[model samples]
Target: MAAASGTRPEHMAPAEVFYDGTEAKKYTSSSRIIDVQAQMAHRCIELMALPPGHRCFILDIGCGSGLSGEALSSAGHAWVGTDISADMLTVGLARGTPGDTLLSDMGQGLPFRTGSFDGAISVSAVQWLCYATQKSHQPYRRIRAFFASLYRCLKRGARAALQIYPENAAHLEMLSAAAAKAGFRGGLVVDFPNSTKAKKYYLCLVAGSGERDDSAAAATSAAGAAAGAAADSSSSSASDGDLKHSDAAMEATDGMGSAMTSSGLVVAMGRRSSSDFEKRRRSRAQDRVGAHAPARKEWVLRKKEQRRAKGLPTRSDSKYTGRRRPDRIT
Candidate 1:
């Protein structure tokens, strides 16, 4: 299929057609794919931030060959994996992947009852919904239906971390918008954003509002305790002024950084100080003034000095430096 044509499998053929018995075997046998999938699965679990030591019933959507499902099992969770490819499921079964495997298409929707799962995760799968290989397949509608079904299957406040490799900005926006329309709250989280190949995207969605509030409260309390411990340690190691300066710098740089608690709840931590805000406001005002201000002797000299320091071509300062020329007689 796609492998034979040297094109991306998603673009070459439908997932079911692309991941046939040969591809399923090849995928499961590859050490690199296995490692990457495992790493991604663990990261997804970390992003889920489920309660420590608590066993969860997780749904693995598009769980090709049960690679991600294996991760769930290792993490002491019971998972039910659903995939569009029967060959992949068969291979997973042969490989003895932990938990159940079902032959199903996620685009058609998850075949589970309401609140059937504690949480959900998908790896390199959700992006498939953005493509329409078949004539009847409407990408937007399929995405909406899949997300709505996912929303209904998750318990209130439960989260789903769907790892996707979107084709472009439009695909990413469409997937996120569809999730939002399906009543899932939250946003996309990108990891290793600067790295092209290493970068990954996860749509971190919450099923409902109540669990979100509870998770936030829990994260806040946990963050407070952690902050207190950190402060105590810093106080012991550094002077009070140094500690305050460091804290202020952190607040300025990490304005409202997210903290994920044990309960899979992400909460915003840290706040921009009033002093920081005032500084930024003053800097902006200075920029505005500088934009229109007439060049003064000091400003011109300062710019020349900066250019000179940077090893750029700069004329030597002379008696006429920054001096205004006499207006030409009209």
Candidate 2:
């Protein structure tokens, strides 16, 4: 719709299919999405460098309910949101083209021409990307290609920033490597607070000059070397302290971006589970981070799952790990 897609539904839309009714999806009433948008907008205000009424061309890669668009408008900028889901786009369009909302996937290669936007911001998107050049959900390779496209799409110095939540070093490593190949300059990967109780996350970002994208390249190279160093440093230390310490090297990011079709915008009641909390785990471990305060919810969920599996009291009485076998996520 609106010059994004001709008629077919590509995979770049941001609205999830199961939640189109919009009663109880995670991001429907979930305020965390807004929290991140607020933070993203703050960054955009500085990064875009646009004056009032400048009519800056903007793209919200995975624009869900148009939260990013709302934030951008508040900052005095025009916006164009494109997603794959008709339902989600419906939600986005309801806000009326505060700018221009379209339906297109970043993976399919941004439908817009080169230098079409002054800035691009992707919030909790990108990390969920899996489509690769070979097809069949090659998430990592697709991520790399997406970045490379960004480099060609923007002008020399346009700002292309993304915030990802990496589950561990592996996540960050993949992003670092791809961003470099994709042609980003320097990016700041920082530390943040997280807790098992509340499920807090950290942001790993790749931000800098689109002109040279040196920082992104450096990040990729450094990450490669670091991976080598970590592997060489201690292949023998399997102890708890060593293994835990291994994760210490993983940092949060402040920026990142990409595209996807819409899915999961609205949902039937009772479809969400506590596990949804960790859906972005890999991405978080790779980018976005929030307050890290220990909470007991994780342990509680673990106990509930155990109890449910054993056909015991639905209520758990002790601390546990929310870990679920991959087969059980559905």
Maximum-lDDT candidate: 1
* Candidate 1 CA-lDDT value: 0.72
Q: Which lDDT tens digits does candidate 1 get at residues 219-271?
A: 43453344334433442212121110122222221221232222222332123
Error of 1 at 229 (Å): 21
lDDT of 2 by residue, 1-330 (tens): 221222211133323443254522344444654565565545444434443467677777777667777878877777777665566667656646476777765665677767767767776556555323233656775676677776666666566545444444455557666766665544432212121111112222333354434443444334334323443343232111111112322222212221110121111111246677677675566443323313345556766788899988685444334323254564
* lDDT score for residue 64 of model 1: 83
**What are the Cα lDDT values of the candidates?**
0.72, 0.49
The alpha-carbon lDDT assigned to residue 186 of candidate 2 equals 42
Worst 10 residues of 2 by lDDT: 259-268
